[model samples]
Target: MEIGFPNHPRRNLLKEIEWIGKNGFDFVDLFLEEDMATPEKVDVNKTRELLEKYDLGIVGHTAWYMPIGSPVKALRSACIAELKRYFRTFAELGVEYVNIHANWPGGLFTDKEGVKFQIETLKKLVEEAKEFGIKLMLEPLDTRFDTVKNISSILKAIPELYLHLDIGHTSLYGRKPEDFIKKFHARLKHVHLHDNNKSRDLHLPLGCGSIEWEKILKLLKKYYDGTITLEVFSRDRDYVLLARDKLIELWNKL
Candidate 1:
């Protein structure tokens, strides 16, 4: 399995790339978002050069704030257009998979209506992404949509859409990571690993929370052998490094 690190939108993308490379990560989950790392602001050619220099692979990540599942057709179309812009940047970077969050607009629609909106938007995205040589994956946030049954329904609606499973998110709302692995392992193409307190998505380092890392790793090994990003969000770089080491150690033991 290839391991990766994500660039925080608050930091310089080029420097983030260098740090991931120097730290021995196999790839970078390039999150093209605001405050710094927007597609218009990022230098794709230069970023590609640095990835080549480090021999690192890339997976595209979009900002979670986008209202892709907005019930309004015009607003949803605008969101899809914005996604295409990111697709162009990711395509230039040779990214194989790009992830979008399942950000359903609350109080604007019923649960059923929201799913319909999301599925419609995803269908267009999946087809358009192919033109750019990229496959789109749906990332579930901390909401009802993150449940196995709910996610499965969306996956059924769009067979081309892949799953971006975040272990940290799964730990919330009385959800078990194993349920996601067992149910959607076949659909999973990329993974995000971080620890949380089971009540909140703190993005803590592995073993520093309520998650059972050893068990999760064992199940993951049996089903997933693809790209995994250490999505830890600690201020100290040492915690990220430590999480990576701990993950490797756990995977080896299993």
Candidate 2:
């Protein structure tokens, strides 16, 4: 398995890449959040050179709240354009899998019309990904709106899609990772590892939050053998390192 940490927004990109490589991560999820890794600011040639220098794999994470399924016409159009644009850019940067959230956060979880729009929009995005020769992964948020729990419906609608499971979000939604891992193992390609309570998505480090790590890791080992990203975020970089170590310890059970 390619175990890595998300190069989240902010900080010096080169330094972070250097640190990730020196510290022994397998890859780095290029989290293109606002401000730092936006297509406008990133130099793909230099980025690729650095990644090769470190011998680390790369993945692309679209900005959170990238609502390709919005009901609003203009918003949806902008989202689709952004998705296509990112697909081309990330593929150029050698990102194998590009991830986007299922739906707009803080929107109606039960928005039937919205979900329909999402499926159609994603169909186009998947085709774009195919053109780029990379995979598009859909990540599920905690709420019902555009959730990975709707995996069956989404997959039926767009067969080429894959899943990026966020452990913290699943726990917050009260969904069982074991069940999804077993059922959708074939389509599950990427993962985000972190800790959160039954409440909101805290994005805390492992052991600092509640989760059955051993069981979850075992299920993951049984199915997925691709990239698993540490999504643990904190102002203190050391905190993320600590979380990564804890996750490695639990994952060793497999």
Which candidate has the top score in lDDT?
Answer: 1
For candidate 2, lDDT tens digit of each residue in 1-254? 77888775676666777778887899988887677767777777888888898898988898877777677768877887777777777888888888878774244545566667788788888877888888888887767553444666777688788888888887766677777777778889899988888678888888888888888888788777788888877778798788777777767767
Worst 10 residues of 1 by lDDT: 103-112
- Candidate 2 residues lying further than 4 Å off, grouped into runs, are 104-109, 146-149
Model 1: lDDT of residue 56: 96
lDDT of 1 by residue, 1-254 (tens): 88999999988999999999999999999999997898888998899899999999999999998888886789899988988988998998899999999877678567677788888889998998999999999888887667777777788999999999999998899998899889889999999999988998899999999998888889999998899999998889899999888888888789
Candidate 2: lDDT over CA atoms? 0.78
> Which model scores highest in TM-score?
1
Q: What is the lDDT for 82 in model 2?
A: 76
**Pairs with steric clashes in candidate 1:** none
lDDT score of residue 155 within candidate 2: 70
